[model samples]
Target: MTQPDNTDDALIRLFNVSKRFGAKLALSNITMDIHKGEWLYVTGPSGAGKSTLLKLFYLGEKTTSGQVLVFGTNMNRLARREIPFLRRRFGIIFQDFKLIAHRNVFENVALVLEARGEPRAMIAKRTRNILRHAGMEMRMNAMPTTLSGGEQQRVAVARAIAGQPEVILADEPTGSLDPKSAEIIIGLLSAYHKRGATVLVATHDTELLARREGRIIRLEEGRLVSSEPAVGEAP
Candidate 1:
């Protein structure tokens, strides 16, 4: 976990990481390195700690024990103010879009830059750029409720990437989309990866993996089961 020079080689790393809720252990002794610009698949059965692992990276939940390092800094020792700064380096997309229903798509994405204290003009410019990338430019002024599930999710993706996070953590991003829609979302994530952003998608959908390929890390019973790199996939 303390790689020092090699730490920068990876955007995320976990060392002997573990988390627990009362007597239920969520993750047990997980240690690994996710290289910068690498696309990784976190595949597993339910209750396998995929979500828990992602949470540790984003500081969404505290690790009951062990070190969770992002960009080579140990989050366990990060001060409260430092935590926010660290989170800004990585965009996290939970299972739900977590959009503010009263807000429009533009506002949902703009909030990111706003929170970062970016000026209004800059926020507006970046907001529009990310929305276009997510193919939701036409829906900018629309409210979350006015859009379909796929559209709302697109808004979430736009918001997540609008800040230019070095890493993107997606938890079942395509879980709710229909077959065709799912393909489109995954493709968008792949596009980000191709652009040199480290991407980790926690999913159990074999169909998603079947369509494309990348490095795969399977977790079962809260343990890392396998790590395989998919090279020269037909897709």
Candidate 2:
């Protein structure tokens, strides 16, 4: 297996990290580094620990052994109260597009800025801009349940990016969308990555990987099998 990147300036680092659920070893001896302003793809079959890996970065799941460091702090030792602060530095997109059914698109997107205590006017302005970018401006007042799958995902994207986080962790972001919708989602992420945010996408879609250019890492049975640049790219 190829060695994981371990540069000094890594924004996120996983060192010999392992996670177990009961008797199942979900992730094994993983060591990887995510650098600032880089786009990374984590690819593997279902249950290969792709989602678990992303969760570990944001503290959704703890490692059974070893350490996960993000933004210079060891997550294994971070206080519960401090997790939220660290999460604020990350924008996470889930496969299910977990939007609140009762909240309108505008409210959903604005909640992030509101949580950060931004001025109401600023929140309104930024939320509107982000919705427009996600092509959800017209649906801003609509409930998430009222939107189509693609539309709802767009709203989720808007919500994820409203805070301008330093890192974006997307887990199977396009797994359920049509080709066109998936393209839009990938486009949004690509645009975000261009703005200097580090992006880590966990997907098993070969077509999606074929269409994007980034470093690719493959996992098999919880073990990292390869880490290499995209095809046609230089090492």
Poorest lDDT segment (10 consecutive residues) of candidate 1: 1-10
- The per-residue C-alpha lDDT of model 1 at residue 48 equals 96
CA displacement after TM-score superposition, residue 161 of candidate 1 (Å)? 0.7
How would you encode candidate 1's per-residue C-alpha lDDT over 7-48 as one tens digit per residue?
558777887888998899888888888888888889899899
> Candidate 2 on 55-157: residue-level lDDT in tens?
9999999999988899989998999999888889999998899998888999999999999999999999999999999999988999998898889888888
Candidate 1, overall lDDT? 0.85
Clash list (residue pairs), candidate 2: none
Which ten-residue region of model 2 has the weakest summed lDDT?
Answer: 1-10
* Cα error, candidate 2, residue 229 (Å): 1.5
What are the TM-scores, per candidate, against the unseen true structure? 0.93, 0.96
CA lDDT, candidate 2, residue 69: 92
lDDT of each: 0.85, 0.91
lDDT, candidate 2, equals 0.91
